[model samples]
Target: MLASVAAGLASTALGGAASAEGGGVPALQLITLTGPGTSGGDTGPGELLARQDAVLAKVGNPTTTYRWTTALNGFAVELTPEQVAVVESDPEVASVEANSVRPMSARRTPVPSSAQVRQPRATGGAGVVIGLVDSGLAPESPLFAGVPGLGRGPKDFAGSCEVGEDWPATTCNRKVVASGWWVAGFGPERIRSSEHLSPRDAVGHGTQVASVAAGNAGVSVRMRGRTIGEFGGIAPQARIAPYKACWGAPDPRDDGCATADLVSAIDRATADGVDVLDLAVAGPPGTDTVERALLGAAEADIVVVAAAGNDGREEYAAHGSPWVTTVGASLGSVWQGRVSVVGGPTLTGASRSRRTSPPTRLVLGADAAAPGATRRHAAQCRPGSLDAAATAGRAVYCERGGIGRIDKSEAVALADGVAMVLGNVRPGPVVDDFHAVPTVQLSAPDAQRLTRWVRSHDRTSIRMSGVAPSPVAGRTAAWSPSGDPRSSVIKPDVVAVGDGVLGAVPDQRGWAMFGGTSAAAARVAGAAALLRSRHDWRAPVVRSVLATTAVPLGTESVLRQGGGRAGADVRGARLALVVRTPRYREVLESGSWGDLNQSSVLVRATGSVTRRVTNLGSRAEYFSAQAIGFTRHRVRVTPLAARLSPGETATFRITVTGPSTPGHVDDGWIRWRGARGSVTRVPVAITR
Candidate 1:
């Protein structure tokens, strides 16, 4: 990662011809200061800006772009190395961090079969406002159309729409109550022509995310003139405040949300009185400016939701802030297609495109390789690697990886291929994506079988059908990462459906299938909005309810699924780690992760941890506790049964004693069964 950053910096320097104008290359920096609420009195925006200006004046005032007074007591400005040194020395300055960029990175079941089932019960998040910090929104998409019964927009919302010649004033309505875009941190000169100046999505990322969170109900999802099915956001009636902080770049690495812009968006979203904040961008788990701003947002009673990441289980989790509800991605049964290899057994593959095509001759990508193109490159369907003559009238078989899924499809389409049989490198989640042609993605085993048949059999022909049962149902996605081992708190508070999620896109494309932890985060954010609207609960309470009420998807470890899939209904004890920490002064107390007041607990080997649970009901309830899934250790929960009145709280101790083995881990659930049939479960993890 460090080498890639260096390479990016070198490329930028060469491309922009930047030099040491103020002792180093120009860079964006987030300046944290000792401002309001840090000490005692509350400082207004004017006072905060004045304080920032005073500090900036000392450094010759490098261009200040974003002023963050609400969620953060700071501002984002572009400065050189010399200016940054002077600003860091200021007594009022708390910290200074160089701005970095992060790429933007769901669906069905586990959350309760479908969000459609929970909407009526939860009132569809009426009167709640969800703030999305992402790329941008596609205002023209039908998913954002104002519903007749949506009524007026939230009166507390302070966000506004930016109007321009291309972007009209009517972009935001009852559904999309507010919209804004930030690009100063990205450098206006770096904005591509395909990018929009308004809060309109050109990359389609933000559009897809928002659709999953709060798009209108019963919108028909379509792709390539084919009608798939009707789907809607979990909180269909919720208002959206879309803040465009990410932008697309020519280079994939450059396609990301800048730290300054992300901070700016979070600051404004908090000020806009959003009930929920949806952050679908991949970022660091550390408490940087963005994390600090998220903490402030939580302090302001906003439920913040973030994505775990798409880097898979090998990498640590992202957005590990205790205050935010980090969500991991899960893949469920997908709409698949049955492909019949004439004279061979039929196999099913995941596919969203239901278009019918005539039986076509099968062509191996290797056989169709263009002159001078490597066989491996041809197998992956590299752009310009397939010969037109060989691929023109055949169903091309392309391997996954080494290129974008859509790019491979485009390559096949460019070579006049009639259809595409896309195969994964290994057995994992098969994602459904928008393709340039009718495409079927097969698992590793099926792919290998089909490849062998295509090579050995002569006069091979294939027939495809959209009707086929999915291979797997409701499992953690292959790309969704696990918890951060460095932090004791089990990350990914819950896993939600993310693979093969249908959502809106920009332009005439209408809709596309999206997969990643980002989509899962959106679903969680929508669920949070529904819970907040129904019960008017605080952010922590909402988070606790979701985690405790969530049902386990499979026999996955705690690090992968945390508290398992997100649950829409609340029926659990609100658990908090009994941490003895100093009162929060200006920021949230960044103590041990075990100290966080969440539904999950993590204890080191042979240690006992205490937790407090509260009854969030109106009636008295008696609860019995039991521990399950613990092995190689003796675990005990004291005071097995507790009878408490409404809003009453009780404490319990979980003691563990066992031989500590290096790199060994033990995990289980501490479940409390309420007399009223409600059950609350908290995940407990022990590591040596």
Candidate 2:
């Protein structure tokens, strides 16, 4: 870990931490401050810095410190150990942390397209501004050029713009209305050849995210001079304001979405007066600076949407705050292409297909290996570890878990293997991803069966279903993280079209595919912009509509899929489930789970709560309410038959009858189902 230099403490004159590169002189260091909530009021960054400087002058160093107020009231200064000791002892200095380098939490969504919602009308996102705090935004793409009548921006917009070397100042048009970059003392070593002092995207992540949410329709996509197709974002008419908070790291290849940079970026975006802030980034589990910024954004009536991250853990499911609707990734059925083994156990998986690649004989890697390496190393399929002469011209059977699937494929390809059969080491769904070679991964059991056949000297021939079927792809992408049952908060408010989503990118005539929660968040953000353009509801109600009306892939965890996939226009929802008190949102004083404090309804001898259901459909609808999934204590719901006329509403009392079990808390949701195929849930909690 790179750390700040802390030196020169003997003397009173503040000789702050000196740099390893620069001679004896001290370098700038981040110093965070806070007031007693009362003094903080109306105490701007300048005043705070002035007060701190006064303290420093009296005690040690008299040099002024650069201050920041937008991302929180903070300052950067070079103070000697004596001065630092005096500042740390001050009553108003709540806490101070060194600004350490943080990695990017890299990670989809498609609710709007499935909802049968179409492109935006003139009023679509008319006055809405969607701000993106990311990297790599290409203004040259035709997506921002806009169509004749719809591209003109809102009349009341309050924002400005900036340009980079390759990016012309005139490129900041009505659609892409604003641009700004936050460069935190970045020296030339970290700068990309194409990047200037401007806010252009040297990295492709920000551009892809921005286009997914707000770029206009009918943007052309081409690869190798051939037009693959055309693509567009959810809200093509919404105005975009880009903030370059993240930059390519010191290597000029990897990038760091640093907290200090992001906080400063948020401060700027908030000041820019954006209606919706879309960021496809998150850090480790905690209530850090970003969460505070999100809360502040929410309080200002700005809807904040963020990614749940790609860690794929059941517990500590990322993005815990309710104020920001957290998004998770899922694959569209179109992402799957069938691959099988003839004269073998029936196998179902996805691949780019061997039909497109050079043909080779099929054999288990162990069967084809040369006499030297261990069975484990050969099976792991590590590059350079396998004997190329023996395995050449054969399809390698490599086990998963030890290495990246792509790395295994690359190894096999380098070893002269025609294709690769990568099998899971543990139980997991078939996760279909495009590999460098025509490769397919099998589930553990399936792989085991194939291994047995190979060792038995039985003939095995692999086949390909060159064409992808139109049916639902085999389950949600197996890697899509689902929520654990321990926490009461309903995570991933929704999933979206994340698998292999094609969108326009930079580098003229370029197009690329994206997956993970970042893609999902962008899709939902665009839909939110569209909804905001036409509705009069506030942020909470908007979030509620997005959460409840979402469609789902049956059998996937409700916690992972939330309300399922999001739809474009929320008004199209036929039936509405309304709960006056949802346990997840209620604030509490003591008991907590992760970052969420539980304030659930107390379960009496017979636990019961009243829930109101309304028929939002044009005609009458049949509905039923029941508790779904497992619970430590059995959760029961009454009124299996709930019939309602249009505009009519009824209340259902749900009860938790069983005795408290071993777990300290009992959590469940009231799942309402309508004959019209409508499904929604409201979480409930009961504590002993």
Q: Name the top TM-score candidate.
A: 1
All candidates: TM-score: 0.78, 0.66
Q: 1-688, model 2: which lDDT tens digit per residue?
A: 0011112112113433222222344533555555311111455656766665665555444443334554445555555454556677876564554444444434323221111112333235666789998874877787777456463456555667765556666768778888877655332346556665567777677888887887776665554444434566787778888887777754643666655556656766765678888877766555555665565566555678887776675434466666677777766653334345555565656554435433345676655555676677678877676777866776788888677666777778788877787788798755554455566667788788877876775566665444443335324555556554454455667777665655556766466666667777888998888778776555655676677766656656565666677754575555544322222223321324323321112343345565556676779988877776536667766676778998687766666677765445555566677787766666554554
Q: For candidate 1, lDDT tens digit of each residue in 402-462?
A: 9988789899989999889999888776666657778888999999999888878877899
What clash pairs does model 1 have? 106-498
The alpha-carbon deviation from the true structure for residue 262 of candidate 2, after best TM-score superposition, in angstroms, is 0.3
Q: What is candidate 2's local distance difference test score?
A: 0.61
TM-score of 1: 0.78
All-Cα superposition RMSD per candidate:
7.7, 8.9
